[model samples]
Target: MSEHHELILTCPKGLESLLAEEAGGLGLEDVREHTAAIVGHAALEVAYRMCLWSRLANRVLLVIGRFPVTDAESLYAQVHAVDWREHLEVAGTLAVEFSGRGSGIDNTHFGALKVKDAIVDRLRDAGGLRPGIDKLNPDLRVHLRLDRGQAVLSLDLSGHSLHQRGYRLQQGVAPLKENLAAAILLRAGWPRIAAEGGALADPMCGVGTFLVEAGMMAADMAPNLRREHWGFSGWLGHVPALWNRLLAEAQERAAIGLARPPLWLRGYEADPRLVQPARNNIERAGLSSWVRVYQGELATFEPHPDRNQRGLVICNPPYGERLGDEASLLYLYQHLGERLRQVCLGWEAGVFTGAPELGKRMGLRSHKQYAFWNGALPCKLLLFKVDAGQFVTGERQPVARDTGQATPARLSEGGQMFANRLRKNLKQLSKWSVREGVGCYRLYDADMPEYALAIDIYQDWVHVQEYAAPRTIDPAKAQTRLLDALAAIPLALEVMPEKVVVKRRERQSGKRQYERQGSEGHFLEVREGGARLLVNLTDYLDTGLFLDHRPMRRRIQREASGKRFLNLFCYTATVTVHAALGGARQTTSVDLSKTYLDWARRNLALNGYSERQSLVQADVMEWLEKDSGEYDLIFIDPPTFSNSKRMEGVFDVQRDHVRLIDLAMARLAAGGTLYFSNNFRRFALDCRLLERYTAEEISAATIDEDFRRNERIHRTWRLQAGKTR
Candidate 1:
């Protein structure tokens, strides 16, 4: 092996330039950037330095040879031509990683097998013991890349990718890879910021990836210094003396860097469960004194009083990937922008997100943007200079301002009366909520027709749904009144303005009800009937847990014990969750919407009710016709009208109730009870259903105290098998 060898350093796509710069900094010669990788020539010491220090690279490969090959036979010949004794001992273990196609090699597995066979045959022909193949921890790792008729073979010198920095033993949801985090920090100019003795903060740091990477950079700590294994550790060509010298140098540098005054590093996460993992990762990186992670909400995110205030605030916030996610994220982005503008005035900000549209919702103009790949997802890092001049007005329409400290919007004549009405309703409902142990319930449901809106409380969070004003009303006047109402609710309810979420509710035909209105996919857990369910106040028209169905859910909890429970048209399966918690023998929840099904699965899993719960994504009508097994207890709550493309046909609860009931009856065991419910305001039960079964209208009984003022919100019926008419 030559003392100077051409090396290839692979990194995540879009990071080739940064890797090239890093190689140049490490004193590698002739550095050139390629797609997703860098090519350079360096002595053995530089390769060892890269393996130990380069934070932006995935793998450091030492090129062994290049050859022209047209088929498997030629590939074997070329691979066998390498003197195996020079790299790997005959008894040592080896693994081959083959990539690319062409030259008749279409499958990577077959290519790897051919390469392995050639190496083994070469050793055997020399009358030496054949090498064993150990894919997990091989003594020598060979990489083969075939393009056209040329093959370039290299030996991986980093064991695993260099991104495995030996710090992250635990992780939060959808964590960013270490190398990707390093690239983001580099692109955000964290190096310069840290060098200037500025602080660093990640408000949404999941498991502290950015903070750990930033701490490493600030302290000049080699990323792989903690790692005990290396690809060249057992390789025959490894120069142990030179490697030891480099390792000692890195250790000395790290010691001096660690003794320097710690950089101001901190992270904030909303989920308490994630904060410990961040701390664990930071401690594992030997950076406990340099970094701190606290469990705190975004609205409370501010620079630490004791740390440097002006620096960089970088985050990879949740990019809405599923239905209802985008709608909730809009508010999050807006809040983030507001916090940066109001609190961290001089800090530079970078937001990495897959949804660029959501980034625009931040209301801060990005001065620079860089495209990056988060695995297969194409994303952008939006950079902003957090100053007053960079703050733009949010997308929310102008509303009357009432920050809870000012004279309430009710000071005006019309606004005063509206505010009085809300106060009265809250007074009435507050007592009921406490007595019933209900953390969430409808507080006001259009008590005064002139100020038509529905106000619901989820713990400390308030969700206000404004009934769309009639077309005959003046648009500007209606908007003014709506804003006034919004301003009054938070003041009268005594909740923070940031905790209030508002949406416009309109009459919908077809799939309009499920259409996304915003990108603030935030869900809050509220308790009802001994069950915990997630309710998203910002995403969809209806929160995942329907407040109007509280009584029905309680009823199911009471009657579902020891029965086979089935829920049809189960939008989020709140009823099924209650039933399962009530000790039902088994539960099957069917819904056509995959979005709601996922929500239901999460709800059930959240309550520790996992075993007997089944969430099926299927049209309830079709599923009912196909299911032959009878359920001891059944609940059917279909939408008023749905013409979803996924449905076999349009569904109208009014016109289809009889047939729907009949199909449901066929799946009900003898003496079983089936509860039917719908939100069609003018719905009437067909007399035919009464004739075929003993049916009784349970609408009034199902309307809890919170919804007593709006009896027409939904209707319910309970039926049992009986003599036919």
Candidate 2:
């Protein structure tokens, strides 16, 4: 049993090299790294020592036999060939775990059953009692892995994953496994820092995982010393005397390490709910004196250590899964950067995040980046050396009371890339805006697939709408790229963060487009086509004025000279105001909602034409059927879908567009034209309507230079009475 035998230490992916190094340090011979595992040769006592000490391994296995396996029968025969009596008693309870797939053993359950049956039949055939299966508490745990028609059967030395550590009883949301946390600390050079007795802090620590792990490492405590049971305890190969000697030595070393002065290890969590849980976990880990946690906000998270003390700042901050969520996470990362710059000078920062691009929002350049896997998702650890000499956007200068010179913040590489694109778009569109005297235009329309966002400029304020990403793309990745673009917005436009408004854009079925996104009734006035429009950029999903139809509004302005104008489905009546600007004699606008009719009233009042314009708050379809009104010029722009309670039936633009256009045409006078438009991406003009009316498709001319990239922004057509003009 004391003879050197092959042992394997399995770890999380990306930590194989680290595990091999640790195995060599643990006195294992011929240590080598493999895929998600480390292979070495060690005596039974050395394997026992590793089971009690190794921090970065999930499991430790002792190889017993390796034999050729072709099918379930061959797998059973090979497993039965092993000397079962030498490992466990014939009546002992056992569990079989199988991994990999090949040679007719397609699944783990079937493979495990074959191994179990083989062991049971072999023991019984030897004139001994049959062993029973005990998955939870087994006297022997057998692990089998099939690779290239070979089965490597082994006895599990560590029953459960070594990462259990038996310290963290309660955890916060998205908790990092104990082994992964140790690997992160090692990568961050925490052992060297701990030996020097430097302070450690986690600003966004949840349940104090890093603090507890760092505390144990600094105190020289064995990770699995407190584990009462192990896979070798019930095996015949276990040497109790050797294990006892190693345990005593570990206990003595822990006592010696704990006698020294405690290092400053502190954690701050933004959630008040997690503060108590973090404290409990710290106390359970016997680190109450060395580690502590407090309820704190990221913006005000300040860790005060002793003088002349510099340490590592490590944290795994909260992340999001949706594109619009970047608005807040972007600021979260920025706040961390601000804190690092303001207070953590001469310190090292290790930021672990699943959304790697969000790491760019911190503005601090990382000297080194290490890739690690957090389960199935890949994450990055950005190592930054906080110093005065490493700023690109410069430091925050003091603001004067009169001048109001706000602090200038730096953009990260990704943020800078997006900012440059925004600047390029603005530079090209500025000439068009100056020539047309247009105050609102689309600055960007998802020019970069990485940054799937539409950025619009309302004179000085910026309006950004995020289109939901596809289902196939990872939400975490989409959100990180989104953070990059959002972090660049204010920097690119040289505007305040408050001036940038963000909203999500999707297919609106009913009155959802007009639904209030916020209660703040703030309004901003922007100009278009020589007309001043009132836009509530903060109060709704839409900013009241549709910038994509800028040229179409101008077309209406030029075509409505001395003609009676009628606007159907008139949302906010911005086009009606343009019609009134073109010397229209009288104009009537119809809508279903009283809120919009009131808004239309305010729009007309803003233009000083209350008498000539009329705002009716009736359902356009129902009202058009009842009215006997005729106009020289008319416009119809309907919603893609509407199921409002007041409306008699649901309205779908694709299904009921033909009926809608014919009703609006009834109100058009002879020789007058009806201009129709809708923003549906898949909108197709009805051939039935085309057969009845002389229609001229003008979709291309309606879209201006700013919206030319997204030709599907909206469709427009000019229609007149009769099949032949």
**Candidate topping TM-score:** 2
> Could you give the C-alpha RMSD of every candidate to the true structure, in order shown?
10.4, 8.2
lDDT of 1 by residue, 1-725 (tens): 67799999999999998899998999789998888999989998899999998989999999999999889999999999999889988889999999998888999999999999998998874566688999988999999999888999999999988898989999887999999999999999999999999999899988999999999999999989999899998899898999999889988998999999998899999998998988999999999999999998886788768534689999999976644343246557766776776667788989999876667656678999999999999999999997767766533223224531222222335656787888898888889888999998888888888788888888998787888888898876776576556546655777766677777788998768876665767788888878888988777888887888889998999998999999998988999999998889999999888888889989999999788788888877888888888899999988888887888779998999899999999988988999999988889999888788989888998888989898888989889999444
Looking at candidate 1, the ten consecutive residues that score lowest on lDDT are 403-412
Q: Candidates' TM-scores?
A: 0.65, 0.72
In model 2, how many backbone clashes occur?
A: 0
List ranges where model 1 is wrong by over 4 Å: 125-128, 306-309, 394-725
The TM-score that candidate 1 achieves is: 0.65
User: Taking the candidates one at a time, how many backbone clashes does each contain?
Assistant: 11, 0
Badly placed stretches (over 4 Å) of model 2 are 125-129, 305-307, 393-408, 411-453, 456-463, 466-485, 491-676, 680-712, 716-725
Candidate 2 residue-wise lDDT at 5: 91
